[model samples]
Target chain A: MSQKMTRRRLLLGGAATAAVAMVKSSFGKMVQTGIPEAAMDPTRQVGPLPGVLGTRSPFEHPQRKASLTSSQTPLQDLYGIITPSDLHFERHHAGVPAIDPNTYELTIHGMVDRPTVFSLADLKRFPAVSRICFIECSGNFRKPDKETITPQDICGLTSQSEWTGVMLSTIFREVGVDPKATWFLAEGSDAAVMTRSIPVSKGWDDAMIVYAQNGEAIRPQQGYPARLLLPGWEGNTSIKWLRRIELSDGPFMTREETSKYTEPIKDGKIRQFSFTMDARSIITYPAYPVQLQKGWVEIRGIAWSGRGKITGVEISTNAGKSWQAARLQEPVMDKAHTCFRYLWQWDGDTTEIMSRAIDETGYIQPSLKELITARGIGTGYHLNPVTAWLIKRGGEVVYRPEKWK
Target chain B: MPYWACVAGIAMISCERRVNTAPTHFGYGRPATKQEIAAKAIAIRPDGKGLPAGSGTVQHGAVIYAGKCASCHGVTGTEGPFNVLVAPDTADAVPFDRAPQRIKAIGNYWPYATTVFDYVRRAMPFNAPGSLSDNEVYSLTAYLLYANKLIDSSTVMNAKTLPGVIMPARKYYVTDNRNGGDGPYE
Candidate 1:
């Protein structure tokens, strides 16, 4: 379906060129092709136009996957780490509620010296900060054999963006946080009225109250007016459509933290508040359903860690026995996706290839066996084990799934 | 000429004002009410502030456990092929890498006791969710606590008693103090 759409766009561009040629011949010397006639000219075409109401690209059209809960980005077609503003992955508990900007207000109360409510305009008046980071769902891992699955299916839940917003510390200062306040409750304005208890230290450390993503006002799906941004934490912690913040002495233990996000560990002990994502790597190119020729194969993939920067990534051609370091792309930012590549000569022998990430904290990517041994085999969330792809003699590549049991 | 120029400038200003008008207010619904807020604020804190008022004895919980929970969690809570919910308090002495031993129940790894009632009432029994009455949930909490030796077999568990039980693993769990300035850990 995507290939068909790309072909149609190319055909439209050709047709537009032919139409321009026809118009040029009809007008002859009286009408210039570069400049519009004075009678029909709207902006005079001499300087920048004053203003425009609506916009649509003459060449391209990109859309989101709409469903009951979440809409996904087109991951298979993206090139870089930063997802386009319109293509950011979206997950809302209730439907996207329409908010009137003038009436939108954020209240900060409870365990604060000065409880205050700030309007949307008031938030923008503060000094702004920008940072690039990736937000990923806790349940993003999926199996490979399903050919119907696009890159969206494998890991579309994760997307990177340059977010512009006010630092949460700035708001905390305005409200004057009480000394006893240890946790904060961030609530959204949606019908579900989603809420989560965030540690107060995170606000002082690196949290942001963002109103923009990828250089534009944030899209409605990515939290239009304003949202919380917790760099390197789980996506849900960055609450969307934010409305209220209440500081407290302890965690609120919301339904999300207790019944949902928490995963049972080995034995009967359930692990809660496990927010930071461990180091992980995945091969994007020459993956399932993409056939390769027996020649120089440029292995391309992405590596990231919520803890910090990705120190190194190693590729294994013969399962887990041997490994070779892959080249990292330039300007590898912290808490952001770093692209990696390896030039390999493929003789097309049946072999399995895999990639593993090592973060700055010296935490090595664990194998499936190691993961299962540590966390037990009951729960299925936050599975970031090294992924492998099997290449047949015929040059067809397939995903090699590791059995859970 | 000066008066004429002033009149022309005023006309231009009026023309610009006709093109745009700033809105004074936005039409949105009223703020959420206190009752609406209370209905959804069903979270059990570590200090047990939101715990419901009900009590259950271990003897009553044993009967309920044998009928409903015993199939999946085991009869005595130690015979689980699924998840073992109970463990001997002395089992913490065993090393993690040693030979396979009894399952590490809530007594060994959980940092807070309030989490047990909070989790079970929300998503337990594998099939039915939120089916257990408040008394039944309290009973189940009592049974699990008594089985793990955190409480006596004859003890009754309610809102007041459940939060007071100290978990053995509370001391081991530590806050993640990682920051980007000094790497991920201290």
Candidate 2:
């Protein structure tokens, strides 16, 4: 026999006012935000009339946790790969500047045959290409020494989006970039005037001047008029609110490059220009704050690598004693987040579930213990360790926090 | 008709290797003027290529620090409402990578003195950034250097003497050597 269905007829081709009034009389106002939104019965009601802009359902609320310098995406609440534009992670030294497209201009000068200034209109006129990729902050890891934490609280700085823009190499060719120019300084228009010196080879290789994100104009939090998009690098190198490009022979050694972003490694050395984010994977479903029921369960997560495509992800249901390959979703693009899923029959035993990703370059994500043995305890940036989620017998889930000295 | 068909057939044959038809230049932007380039080129390198002509003394810097910077960075630069700016009992002698607990302040971790001026000029005071004059920036730089015990109290900081001050952490810096493979992490 077929499953039972709701008995209400589907409403169509009628004025929304009559349906809204009828629903309001029965249910009384549900939401008090002036629009009588969500004031309808769940099983049967006429939805709001079509408006100019779309809004998310009143039942769902996914938001980014913000601080003074940065904000983290709601990774646990998110599903699939592409992050919503407004919900994408943001990190600004000063603050997002309100730029008018008519007055905004990006100037490319120094070590070029022709120095030129391109307005937003000028950049849009060039050939545009779109691709999906992830931009992760170098300081993404937070070893706060606590067991109670969510994925957003642990590592929410990584976000993926489909960006549309003209390739920076196209503009480089138009300006006649000099062969001797090895480095270029990219600067922002914010109050900090953030600057970073990137290698010139990245321009010829997949760098883009992106202006649109996820099928719409880019949000001001991610750069409104334009921002630099360096695929497979740390997010800061992809400077937002891009204003200037100055080609040169050497690194500018700005305050960002020398004092702040650089991380200390083993021995007496400090690592400069560590751009690529390594392979990382975190189980989002069984993570903290989500209660589990012991039965036939499906574990799901996202895996990504800055160097190349994620080849495979291994799930360890019985802790680190053994591992099995999880099934990968189709159309796994290069340098983009790929979703993976695995099926397991939980025997109501308290155990830890974990995931580790392997990139196309055969670099496997290391454990926190293995990372500490190699890079020592002092290294801070680019911390991409395999994360584990602990499941309790009473149907409680929590993050498996690693101890760092 | 046969002649035209033969020409079309030849065109199809020529498409075997997908001949490159992309233009070398699309010419989308206008030439930038000298004035516009000068207005936005604000990055200052370690070799001191962009410092404006200004001089400041440590005496005047103390007064300016009390008025503008003391609210955020503390009056003595060591006690911080935010970031501690001064050195605490010669913390530079401790190797930061080896010692995990050492706090990174301007007195220990920064590799160049020019960065101090460059950062203050671009973003500082924590409230109203980019509001300090060049002379006031130089003065604050002098006061901070003196507070960190890197410079003498009588020294005058200008574009010339500022770059010459050697930071202790300069020699410890190295380029990133990490290459992704099955090898050990760098």
Measured by TM-score, the strongest candidate is 2
- TM-score per model for chain B alone? 0.74, 0.85
Summarize candidate 2's per-residue lDDT along B8-121 as a digit string, tens digits: 988898895467556768888899999988877877778887788898888888999999888887879867787778867464475666677777777777888889998888
Write the residue-wise lDDT of candidate 1 on A1-405 in tens digits. 644433222112221322111122453543213322234332222322222332332234555565556777766566768888767888877567788878887777778766667778878877789999988877666643453454566676788999999889888877778978999988787655667889999999899999998888888878879999998888888998888888889987665665456665554455667778777788877687788899899888888888889989999888778999999997688888888889998987988888988889787777777777776664555767787878889988877766764
TM-score of 1: 0.65
**Interface RMSD value for candidate 2, one decimal?**
1.3
- Across A239-264, the per-residue lDDT of candidate 2 in tens digits comes to 99999999998888888888888887
Docking class of 2: medium
Off by over 4 Å in 2: A1-39, A42-45, B1-20, B89-92
lDDT of 1: 0.73
For candidate 1 chain A, which ten residues in a row score worst on lDDT?
A: A15-24
* Chain A TM-score of each candidate structure, as shown: 0.85, 0.91
Which pairs in model 2 have colliding backbones?
none
